[model samples]
Target: MRLALAQINPLVGDLAGNGERILAACRQAASRGADLVLTPELSLWGYPPRDLLLQPTRLTRQQEVLEAMVQELARTMPELALLVGIAEPKGGGQLPNLFNAVALVEAAGWRVVARKLLLPTYDVFDEQRYFLPGDAAAVLELERRGQRWRLGLTICEDLWVEEELQGHRLAGPDPVAALLPSRVDLLLNLSASPFGQAKVPLRHALARRAARRLNCPVVYVNQVGGNDELVFDGASFVVEACGELACQLACCTEDLKTWSPGRHPAPGPPADAVLPEPLEQLFRALVLGVRDYAGKCGFQRALLGLSGGIDSALVAVIATAALGAEQVRALLMPSPWSSSGATDDALALAGRLGLITHTLPITGLMAGFDTALTPALGQPPSGLTAENLQSRIRGTLLMAVANQQGRLLLSTGNKSELAVGYCTLYGDMNGGLAVIGDVYKTSVFTLAAWLDSPAALPCRRSLGLPERGELIGAAIRHKPPSAELRPDQRDTDSLPDYGELDPLLRALVEERRSQRELVAEGTDPELAERVSTLLRRAEFKRRQAPPVLKVSGHAFDSGWRMPIAAG
Candidate 1:
């Protein structure tokens, strides 16, 4: 029996569009002479429908759409059976709780065989509030290739993580473990797993082990493309019953792979597919993520202040790559402390990239604020206070354009700045989405280097960027990182260099190491103490910060919730 895995991407809540995508994939799969095609978890409506599951009418609409999809599948491909993940209705007085259910449709009709037994409660998932746990395992029997095949079905979270602190004994058996007793011909697991910096290899290893332990061939299908704040890099593959990878699909793109039950698995690299360079992957992930988020959230264009510094320049480059040059408008909001080179660099970049940018000199606006506050605030604030005002004015001007043109404002601050409260609140912090808020300052330079290389590593979408060009070289590099808000400004003049700071931050914030522990790891005692202090002080700011892309094991979002008080 040939089973096709349609590893695909779907925009949340776009029922008609998602249906079209499913139809296209199923047609391609049918053309390959596959008996059955399986899509990722919730491929019909997208993953984690969140509050939409709470609305009764939304569920009704989803049900209607599913019936339509089944009718279309039955008519279009009578020989091919299709499996799709969707929200199934539970006939109870309960608040219309959601279920991760799958529909098995053939020439006859559709039947829901499996529903997710486990509901994830932690780490960006709040399934318990909306979903009711299922009670039974599913095994669908079908005739394929003149042989009777029994398929064990499971959803995304079913394969990972054991049940913890179960209150009732009637939660049924673990799905993967239960499949052993069912003795199915194949185990199909559909997932919408989000991407992290070094997580792809780990998933492949887990799938391989699961197939071997279950004593059955495992067909793993993962959702691809970007969903708001999340990018699912679909590197879906199959593992033979003997623990060898059979067929593999492309990463970060829509793809398919067909596998037969008896064939020996194809050998590849030790870690499944060869991963792209870190910078290339991150750049593609960010661009695709931003494009989808903006496009899905009902926005067409984006606007941001191009300070001509590394951060803003990178944002402009990425924005142009994401939404096209015409859709991206850059504003060079220079102040009294800004250098001529900074302005020149901004204009030069805008010209090179075919972006229309306005040189909005904020010097006049700064003078007005200074004059207005001089009497009441006593001769204008100095140091951090004055520097922050410049950022605020630039943010205000950018927001004005954003409001006028209905463009989403892009914020240009990296993780290093955000870590130590170096960014101004409501200033550079004003944005609907933060593109590179999770990226470290050092990694930013690395990405620029990748983009400037002759052999441009395969990126998802065309960037329209020069093959070999230094976006930020020694002049921008030699100078200490700065906000350029004050005279002779240097970022190190206030905080530690990013090289010294990022490690300390990882140790403290991500690794959850104490100040004493961080100091012992070759981190300066004074610097560690300072970083700890800044983290504590910046809690309020981060609390109000926009949602950042989660790329690391310990991304600073709701994932790494920290207490305000210092130990």
Candidate 2:
């Protein structure tokens, strides 16, 4: 059978819109003579519909949409069959009376063909709270040309059962193993997995393992687009049982491809099987995150404070690429402490990117704040208070511009600073989205350098970035990391050098390593203790920060739920 994998971008909670999107893909698949079409998990309502699943009206509307799809298919293409992911209501008195399900829609009608066996509760997922896990593996038998084919169906987390490969395993039924007795001809996994460092390779490894065990070719279809803080990279592919890639789709964008199981030789990776370089993948992911976040939130433009620091410079580049230079505006809020060289670099970088910039100096605003607060404080704000006052002034100005212009303010703080409470609350932390709050300061430098290098030309062109020369410019790329909130201030003055700090932060935040363990692993004893204390102390600030576009495995977003009052 010719199977078409629909890698689509769905808006969350838009049942009618998502249904239309699915029908469009079905039409494309039908034109290609595909007998069957597959969409990602929760394709109808998008992944992690969250509390939208709780509303009775949406549930009723879901049935209406599904029936409408059935009629449209019967009227248009009677011979084609499609698998659509949905939330199937289970009647009775159970609390979570719904199953994360897949409905097979043909000319006759639709039926729930497969229910997700694994309900992942970790990370950004909380499927267990809304879904009742299925008890058995699902096999859909199809008869085409008088020949019966048994196809195994698994949802996103069902195929993520390889503990050794994934380093950790969710405790549940092994969906892949359950399919062994059925002797299925093909294994299909419908997923909405988010993009993370090396996640594509891990998915490949899991699928390859399942293919070998089930002794059948595996087709993986994933949802693409940024939904809130999560960005899905639709690098879908088909893998042969012999552990060779048969076909691969595009990354960080919507795609559709059809492939028959035994069409090609199982010798080597296909031309499209080669993944993009790691940096390219990362860059594309961030761009997609920003684009979808702003677009979904009804923002036509984005605003950010460009202080000539590496963090803001990198954010400016990403915002320009995501929304176009015309849609991205930079506010250069310089203070008395701001250096002329730094301001010059910010302007130069903006020129290269063709970004609209407004230099709103805050020196006068700083003076006004001091005068207004001296009576209440009995003394003018000084030291750290003075530095933070500058940041708050710039943030207020940026917010006012964003409010007046109806633009989304993008926060430019890095993960390293957020981890240590180095960022000011309601100051630099103000934004609609944290574009790089999940990225380390060191990674910011790396990304900036890569943007300037020649290797990024193709990706740059794809994103509508300037491909001829350096986009970020060398002056900003090589500048020392600073906030420019105080005179002669450097990031290292408050925190450890990022070269030494990022590794520790990674271990503490991502790996969940203890302070004792860090010291045991040869980290400086006092440094580890200090970093750990700071990480804990920063929980309240992180809790109040903007929704960070999550790129790493562990981000200070919905997943990091540390108690604000805890020691």
Candidate 3:
């Protein structure tokens, strides 16, 4: 049987739109001569529909969507069998009363074929909040042209046999192991896996393990495009029974690929499984995140404060790539303490990217703020508060430009500064979206170096950025990291050097390691304790910040939920 993977990007809670999207994919798959088609988890209402499922009439609305799909199927491809992901209601119940499920739709009609077993609660997924688990493994009997194929269907987290692979397990049944008794012809895992540095490799390892366990070709289809802070990378693939990759799909975009039962992919690395270099993967993910976030939120243009620091420089590059240079404008707000070289570098980089900029010097305004506040306070604002006033001045100017022009204001703060209490609440934090908030200071430097290298010339040219030599000129990239809020101010003055700090932040934030665990790993006890305290103390600041574009496993976005009042 010809099996088609319809990797689609669906908007959350747009039931009518999502249903149309699924129907279109199914029609396209039928046109491609595929007998069967599979879609991502929760394709009807999009994954993590969140409160949309809690609507009083959501179940009734879902039925309408299913009926619409059935009508579309009957009107178009009468013989094609399409499997769609949906939120199936379990009648009336207390608390959660739904299951993440798939409906097998044919010309006759549609019915719930399978319900997801494992409801993941960790790392951006809060499935348990809405769904009740399915106890039985789902095995579908697919019939086409007198041939019968037994295919097991699993949702996003169902195929994640963590105990066998990661040595630890989440609270769930082993979906892969449960399929052993069925002796199915093939296994299908519909996923909405988010992009992360380590996620791609880990997913492949798990796919190989499942294929080995089930002793069947495992087909994985995933959702694509940016959904809020999460970007689902649709790198779908087919793994053979012996752990050999048979076919692979594209990444970070909508893709459709097919695989036969006995077919093996052309030799060399698995096309979809060939992991990109860390920086490239991160850059692509951010670009997708930015483009989709802005597009979805109804913004055609973006504006940002360009400080000539490494953080803003990197953010400018990403924004330029995501939205064209013409659509992304920069504001150079130079305070009295801002360096001349910093202004020059900002202009140079903007020129290279063909970006438009308005240089608004805040030096005059800083004097005005100090003069006006002196009488009420009985003293001129000095020290940290004075430094932050400069930032607020720039932020207000940027927000005005963004508001007047109807553009998104992109925040440039990185993980290191935001991890601590180094950032001002409404000062530098003013923006519609935080482009690189998940990226660490050290990683920012590495990404800059990579973008300037000869390897990035193709990407630079493709994005219409100047590709003659270095894209992000050496002067801007090699300079010491600074906020330019005060004279001779460096990031090292407030926090540890990035080389030492990034590892510690990674342990504390992403790994969720305690101070004791960090000290056990040769980290200085005092330094670890200080970093931990800062990370916890800064939660309030992060709560007020813009929605951070997530690239890491644990971002200070929707996923990393922490308590502000509790220890």
- Compose the digit string of candidate 3's lDDT tens values, residues 1-567: 898999998988888898888888877888788899899998888876899899968778889988888887888888888888888878776879888999998889899999999888887888889989998999999888688999999987887777766655677688888889999989999888888887777777898888887788888898988988888878888878887777777777777876668666566656455645667778888888999899989999999887877888888888988899889999998878889999998898888888899999888898999899999989999998898898888889988998999999999899888999788887899998888899998898889999989877766776566778776778988898888777788889988888988999998888888999888978898899888899999999999999987788789988888989886
Candidate 1 lDDT over 1-567, as tens digits, reads: 888989888988776778789888889998999889899988888875777777778778877777777788778888888888888877678764567788886767777888988777666777778778778777889887789988888887777643232212223457777777878888898888887776566666666666876788888899988777777877788877777667777767788877778865446633444557666667777887778788888899999888767887778878888888899998998888999888887787787677898888988888888899899988976767788898888888888999999999888888877878878888999988877888888887777656655545335234665444554444444445677898888878888778888888777766678999877867778888899899778877877777777666566676667776656
Residue-wise C-alpha lDDT for candidate 2, range 405-452, written one tens digit per residue:
999999999999999999998799999999999999889889988988
Clashing pairs in 2: none
Q: What are the clashing pairs of model 3?
A: none
After superposition, candidate 2 runs with Cα above 4 Å error: none
Against the true structure, candidate 1 reaches a TM-score of: 0.92
Query: Which predicted model would earn the best lDDT?
Result: 2
Off by over 4 Å in 3: 264-267, 270-275, 461-464
TM-score, predicted candidate 3 vs. hidden true structure: 0.97
How many Å off is the CA of 362 in candidate 3?
0.9
Query: Cα RMSD (Å) per model?
Result: 3.5, 0.9, 1.6
Residue 386, candidate 1: how far off, in angstroms? Answer: 1.4
TM-score of each: 0.92, 0.99, 0.97
C-alpha lDDT values of all predictions: 0.78, 0.92, 0.85
What is the alpha-carbon lDDT of model 1 when measured against the actual structure? 0.78
